[model samples]
Target: MNFKHMTAAAVFAGLIAGCNVMGTPLPDPRLSGRDAEFMALAPQARVNSQFERYLVDYKTNEPVGSIIVDNNAKFLYYVMPGGKAVRYGVATGQDAMAFTGRAYVGGMQEWPRWIPPKDMLERWPHLQPTADAGGLPGGPDNPLGSRALYLYQDGKDTLYRIHGTNEPDKIGQAVSSGCIRMRDIDAIDLYNRVKVGTKVVVL
Candidate 1:
């Protein structure tokens, strides 16, 4: 594969894991110092960050077919037919998260385990101790947080995930290693709404 394709695949693959359990959480990243001040305004302010809206339009009220991620708006929409979409606030992948195409929801899980990556272990020697220590239990601190939706295409793993995050403040920003993240509550809500084999469009 050429650089663009390779880059895209790597980006999607990193997102697939959603969160890192063995490594330390990355530092908060805002677009600018002004963005930092905006974050400091309060949790409500963070949650209420301005984001563009796009309503779904079609035949049925149920979102039976596809999931769309509007990266710029920091919103994930499950497209239901008949002019309806379930929108969720999201935290996106940082420098590495850049999947621009189609994939399928191959599997879904609740309170999933987390295994740190080799590079993460290399970066943080402490992670080496936990590399073989097994997956972390699900709960407040688990990187994967509450839920995970794995993305796959053509019978292969795409390595991108739309999962829940513990940090509600991180929504609408780029911070994670490379995952389409959502608040725990919102994730559970979306989790209940989606199923295996759903179509996912990450652009």
Candidate 2:
């Protein structure tokens, strides 16, 4: 090709190389154990590349260490000490059940059990048997994948959670019962950064 054409193509490639492109499902050495679990789970689906975790510049009036869920954007930001945040892709609640406004992380659990709430059982009656059986035990098969941070307001359970998901591909979508779903490793990472009573704002 002509020299001018080659120069233009090189510029375009440089632009792409300079952009922030995150990879999905993480390749952290620590997650090697979970790789086996993932393989055993349902067939994996492709997550939108943009949904991957990122450290970005964020301007917010909220204080440091706060958790903010921008439901419209399908992103949950853990505000850092400065004007920065660690953002993670999330699957939010459907329109009829989405939780908005503010709440606190009232409780946290690792590898939490899956209890089909009464309302959920009402919608999915087949879950009644599981509910009657007193919920599914925590493990690889549980829907609350690796951890859970229970949201609460006014000292009452909001029946919503920010938890790990077995379906990472659902990130950047609206399909959950009401909880915020993150990739398993993302949940674990966020769990470590958060403590009970951390403020959570859903917008």
Candidate 3:
């Protein structure tokens, strides 16, 4: 190639490189390391595309800050402004075990303790310690994975929760006792986005 042609080609390549560098900044190495460490605690399973979080076209008259749980679809949507929402896969209660209707997030806990209810203890006698000892201490192995959002109606506890689960593979299924279950990482993300008084609609 001629010298002038070579120079022009080099300039074009340089411009393209510059644009790419400016457009896509590299992720912070420190943040990447932290993410790696966090994900190591709860490994995510390979999930289907439908179970992935996405910004979807959601039209709802309910105010922004409202959480909608589509039990049949096994999906949870945190409504946002401008007819959009952040959707996440969730595990709801099985057949007759599900709770329906509206409730508000009365409280939340990070790495909350797990106490087996009377019936649960009766069904699984091995879990008697969890009841007799008050509750199981929160940790990586805790059933409440990373966070728990307690549901309430008219200031009264509803005995239900939207919580993280130790079994990430069950995210898109209906298997919980009566509460909504999310993956550990997704739970943490939702916990950070929502407040104590956020409205929840379980359908």
Candidate 3 lDDT over 1-203, as tens digits, reads 24465677797887778554222221212223434554567656866667766777789889998999999999999998988787888999988889899999999998789998776777789998678888977666778877899999999998899998888888889898888998777787788789989999998
Across 1-203, the per-residue lDDT of candidate 1 in tens digits comes to 24465677687767654543222212222223432343333233247533322243334333455788877767788776656676666878775655657888898987677777665677678866566778666556667766799999998887778887667778888887677888665666677778889888876
TM-score ranking from best to worst?
Answer: 2, 3, 1
Of the candidates shown, which would achieve the greatest TM-score relative to the real structure?
A: 2
* TM-score of each model, in listed order: 0.68, 0.86, 0.80
Per-residue lDDT, model 3, residue 25, is: 23
* Candidate 2, lDDT over the whole model: 0.83
Candidate 2: 10-residue stretch with minimal lDDT: 20-29
Which model scores highest in lDDT?
Answer: 2
C-alpha lDDT of all candidate models, in order: 0.67, 0.83, 0.81
TM-score of 2: 0.86
Runs off by more than 4 Å, candidate 1: 1-46, 49-64
What's the lDDT for residue 179 in model 1? 76
Between which residue pairs do clashes occur in model 2?
A: none
Worst 10 residues of 3 by lDDT: 22-31
Let me know the TM-score candidate 1 reaches against the reference structure.
Answer: 0.68
Instruction: Name the lDDT value of residue 51 in candidate 3.
Output: 73
Q: What is the descending lDDT order?
A: 2, 3, 1
